[model samples]
Target chain A: MNTGASSTRRRHSGRIVTALLFIAPWALGFLLLVLYPFAASLYWSFCEYDLLSPPRFVGGANYRRLAHELLNGEGFGRAVWNTAYYAVASVVLSVLAGVGLAVMLSWKVRGQAIYRAIFFLPSVVPTVAAAVLWMWLLDPGGGLVNHWLTAVGLPAPNWFKGVQEALWPPDWWSGRAAFGSKDALVLMSVWGVGNFMIIYLAALGDIPKSLYEAAALDGAGNLRRFWHITLPNLSPVIFFNIVMGVIQAVQAFTQVYLVSEGRGAPAESTLMLSLHIFLAAFQNLEMGYASAIAWMLFVVLLAATAALFHSSRYWVHYQGGSP
Target chain B: MIHDKATFRAHLLLLSAAVLFAAPLVWMLVSAVKPAGQLTQDPYSFWPREWRWQNFADAAAAMPFFRYMRNSLLLAGGTVVGSLFSCTLAAYGFARLRWPGRDLVFGLLIATMLLPWHVTMIPRFLLIKELGLYNSLAALIAPTFLGDAFSIFLLRQFFRTIPEELSEAARLDGLTEWGVCWRIVAPLSKPALLTVGLFQFIAAWNDFSGPMLYLSDPKKFPLAYGLEQFVSSYSDQTHLLLAAAVMFTLPILVLFFIAQKSFMKGVSTTGLKA
Candidate 1:
């Protein structure tokens, strides 16, 4: 009995060592890449640090600056408004467009696979290339979109060069003013709505056909059947898309950076939070201020996500149990 | 009869939507071959007056195109090798091994995925600089050797699906844990490994922000960043710009076509699971 117990203990210890060996790379990474950075950023948020000099402790200074900017409509204030506008507009439009496209694609039709493939193609285009392509397409003059609009007897907006004052002009407001750079960005985002559409398509596939057939047998029209059955089944996926879309829109940098000429051109109309942080840390060399802004962004994201989860109880549908 | 009519109408609507979705890509391809004069003079024409294939050569000559391409390939290759090696081992540890604190560690890994990169961006840059890897390709490639949350999670999920009996039998045959992982589990997990490899490859190839942040030298720029530089300088040369963009996008498009099944499966799985 003593011998068996000793052998078992040895085996347990050996397994533990082996496990550690296997996970060593990730363990090292978690320590250096994640944990250290997380702690350092939190600490730096309170101190004034540039790369050249040692960090100087300035408790609440950074936070006070951010608060002042937030209230007085400075750079950070502009970024907040821009990010909120972009995130809300992009998320709402993409969800509506994605669900609409998915429903259309899910219909029983010939060449369905081809249609799906074509729709999914744009999302695969590299970001830089997509940005470059859209730049030409939305060129204020001699661009294809404007050319088409003119050919169809419609007005052409100076996309990427105009301001947002004309997005929803009142009927009494009659001017030749065009949609602004952010509107141009919205158009570009909706063009890449294929990624979310793919998600909706997959979820749509998982809904049992029996449900549809049952509704049909109950004398439901197509609209009624879709409204009663499909919408409920799709609520979870729609919710997921909204959350992810918000996160993505908040973090949208590369394309925005590319389109806005890398400095939020056209009167800072396209300055976003991610770009603002990047410029602060790298361009302006204000590491401490950048850290503070990053923490604020983090808190906002966490609050938004929590609010979503709170509200999800009222609407999100689950098949088996509460998700 | 009513259903048939509805299906026909749906087909028509889908066909039109497909055309609209594909129009920009089609425009890109057609415009790439248009002469510089035609682009300005006859902008609305769908077909080029003459196919100026020489525009590709001009674009290539305007920049160090081949050098950028080589750098892109090297970065993608190195990142794939590093990610596959590190992530697989980490995944095996998390999935197959029985050890204390495993569940807690795994939860931490998942939580890290949600932590915004901005929170770690500055310090990570400083850390790489401290390692004396700044402005080098190594600065970008070295991080993958550590591990990634998404790749590890994907591989761990795959590893858990394998039968335990095989590993148990391998262990009873005097095979060590490494042998059991390498000889038994790795062989059966080819699809998952391929998914991770493909993902890392595409990510590295299309990575602009990394090269932009780390490498300042024009010689070190990958195709994605280098092409953007080209755009900033030669934005007026619409034909040449279009050609360069097409050249940059074609390889990724071809890769997607060749691996469409795996790509679609990976995308759908990640989406549904998330």
Candidate 2:
């Protein structure tokens, strides 16, 4: 009995050592890549440093400039508002569209696989390439869309050039209509909604045939079944998708960067916070300021995730709650 | 017969939606050949009055297309091998090993998924710089080799689905733990390993940010990053730009076409289903 117990302990210790060895690489990378930089960034956020000079710690100066001088005077608040607007609107629109399409596709439909492949094609398109494609597609005047619109006696708005116009034009939009305020970015983003659509489709597939069958037998119609059985069942996936979407949206750099030609222009209408951070860091060489913005973004993402998790308790239905 | 009619209606609806979804891709292909004037004059027109086959050749010539392809293929290929080796090894530890803090460590990996990439981006860039890997393909490939938490977690979940008896049988036959994992478990994980490889291939191929951050020489750029040259170049040639975009997209599109069903099946079986 004593020998068996000692052997068991020895085996357990060996397993522990092996496990540690397995995780060591990731743990080292995480510390060096993620944890250390995070701490260093926070330190730099309070300092005044370019790459050339030693960082000078100036307590509250960076924060104050970012908050008071910048936010109040130069419409930094508007940029914040724009990011939030884009993030929330894109998440809501994409999620709804994704879920709706997934449901539509989930029906015992023909060519289902083909439909999925088609929708998912855009998701696989490289970001830079897709952005280039959209720049031509969404060109304000004399583009394909405008050409069609005018041919049909409709007005065409200058997509990239125009600002201060409604994103989606009304029925009365005519030749006098103006282009929207960086709404072209929004329009292009919707095309890539295929990513979330895949996730939702997967979730929809997992909604168990029995649940839908039971609902049908109980005289629930399609919409009714969707609401009670499907929606509730899909809540966790929805929650996951939303959080991921929000994170991605906040880091919306490549599209905006390439689209605006890295100027974040069209009256700075498309200057997403991520691009703003990039410009500050790389372009302007304001590494400290950019670090500050990076930290701010970190805080915002943390808050958004916390809020989602806090609210998830009310909505997201796990098989067994609070595991 | 009625059931058939309903199925037929569903097919029609599915086809219509698929057409709508595929419209942009079709537009992309058509626009690539479109005359510059026709592009602006009739953007929605599917039929290009003038075909510009040279546009693809020109796009290819504008950059080191072959070089970029080699770099992308190498980066993606290395990422697949690295992710498979590391993720499977780590996942085995999580799935089968008995250890203190096993769950805790796995939880840490999962939590890292929620930490925004922006939070880690600059730090990772700095780490790569400090490691003296910057400007080398090693920079692009090494970070990927560290293994993604999501991929590890995914393989771990798949690993858990295998019965414990398999591993026990190997142990009874005098196989060491590592040997059991290699000889027994690895063979049983073909579907998952393929899925992880496919996902890594697509991701590493599409990634513009990593190469953009690290590589400086345009020749060293991956196809995705190399294609950015057309946009930033001093040319207003929309035809050439579209052609370049088409060139960059074709491999990934073809890849997706080949592995898409398996990829979709894998996703459905995994966390996406959760």
Candidate 3:
């Protein structure tokens, strides 16, 4: 009996040792990469470090500057609006377009795989390549889009050069039709919404065909069946993509950097939050201020996620039960 | 049979959407082969006025295109090895073993996914610099060697789906835990492993920011960043620019065709499960 107990304890210790050995790599990563950086960033948000000198305690000065900019519609304010416009518009538009395309792809049809390949190909196109492609396509004077528009005798906005927002033209837009950099970026993102469309199509497959059959038996037409059966089943995925899309858009950097000449040029019209943080830290070496902006973004994201989850209860219907 | 009128309308709408979605790519191909000066000229023809296949050669000559591609492959290959090595071990630990605080630590891993990269970007960069890894491919690849949470999560999910009896049977047959991980569990999870590798490879390949951040030396610039150099200076040479973009995109497109199943599985399983 004594030997058995000792052996059992020994085996238990062996299991613990094995688990530890297995997890060492990730634990190291979590500490060095995630945990330490997280704590350091929070602490630096209050300091005034310039990467060349030691950090000096500034005690809310950076936050105060953020608040001032936020209130005045200046530096940080512009980024907030740019990020909000791009994130909200792109995610919302992608969900709508994704669901529509997904439904179309889900149709019982020929060449389905070919159609899927065509759509999915864009999302996988390298961002640099895509950004360059769009830049030329939407070029103001000699590009394809404007060429076609001018051929049809319509107006073509100076896409990368223009500063006007399409949907909510600012007071400065002044009764002119113009598509700006952010507008172009949003269109570019929607063009790549094929990835999310793939997800929605997958979710659409999980929906029971019986639901649609029952709707049809009740004399419901195609649109009605889609409205009732398809939309509800897809709500969960839509919500998930919305959350992810917002996060992606918030961190969207490369395209914004490339298109706006690394400084959000063309009058800083595309000065997104990520680029703003990049320029502040790396470009100007204002590490503390950049950390402050990053913290602000984190808080906003947490709040946004919480709010979405709160709101999701009403709309996102899980199949088995409520989330 | 399905209604003929509705079917025709559906096909038309779908075909038009396909055309619209594929427009940029088609335009890339068409513009790539257009004669050099013709792009800046009088008439805009949809098809190339002359098939200047020479534009592709010129684009490659205009930049260190092959060198950039080799660097890209190196980064992608290095990240895949690192992620697979670290993540597979971590996943088996989480999935197969009972350890105190395991669940809590796994929770932290998942939460790390949502923490925006911007929050940690500066410190992480500084960390690399302090480690004397800045401006090297290792600066990007080394951290991936530590492990990625998303890959770990995917792998853990797959490892959990694997029956515990297999691990137990291996143990009884005298395999150690590490032996079981490598010899038994790892072999069975090849598809899951491939999915994770594909994700990281695509990520490292398409990454504009990583190469932009860590690698400043033009000699080390991957295609993604190296190609952008053309955008700033030589964008006026639209044919060469388009040709380069097409070439940059072609391999990944072909890779997608080859591994479409793995790619589709990774996206769908992660999305649906989340």
**Tens-place lDDT digits, model 2, residues A206-235:** 778898788889999878987898898889
Query: Which residue segments of model 3 deviate by more than 4 Å?
Result: A169-177, B272-274
Clashing pairs in 2: A140-A158, A140-A159, A144-B43
lDDT of 3 by residue, A183-235 (tens): 89999999988778889999999999899888888999888988888988999
lDDT of 3 by residue, B1-274 (tens): 5588778888998899999988889878888998987788843678777899999999999999999999999999999999999999999999999988899988988899989999999999999899999999999899988999889999999999888899899989999888999999999999999889888888889899988889889999889899998778796788889899999999888889999988888888785211
- Each candidate's DockQ score against the native complex? 0.69, 0.51, 0.66
| Residue pairs with backbone atoms closer than 3 Å in model 3 (clashes) | none
Better of 1 and 2 by TM-score: 1
Find the 10 residues in a row with the least total lDDT in model 2 chain A: A164-173
TM-score of chain B of 2: 0.89
Sorted into a CAPRI-style docking class, model 2 comes out as medium
What lDDT does each candidate get? 0.89, 0.77, 0.89
- Calculate the i-RMS of every candidate, to one decimal place: 2.1, 3.0, 2.3
Candidate 3's DockQ:
0.66
Which 10 residues in a row give candidate 1 chain B its minimum summed lDDT? B265-274
Point out where model 2 deviates above 4 Å: A1-7, A73-78, A152-154, A165-182, A208-220, A317-323, B1-16, B35-44, B266-274
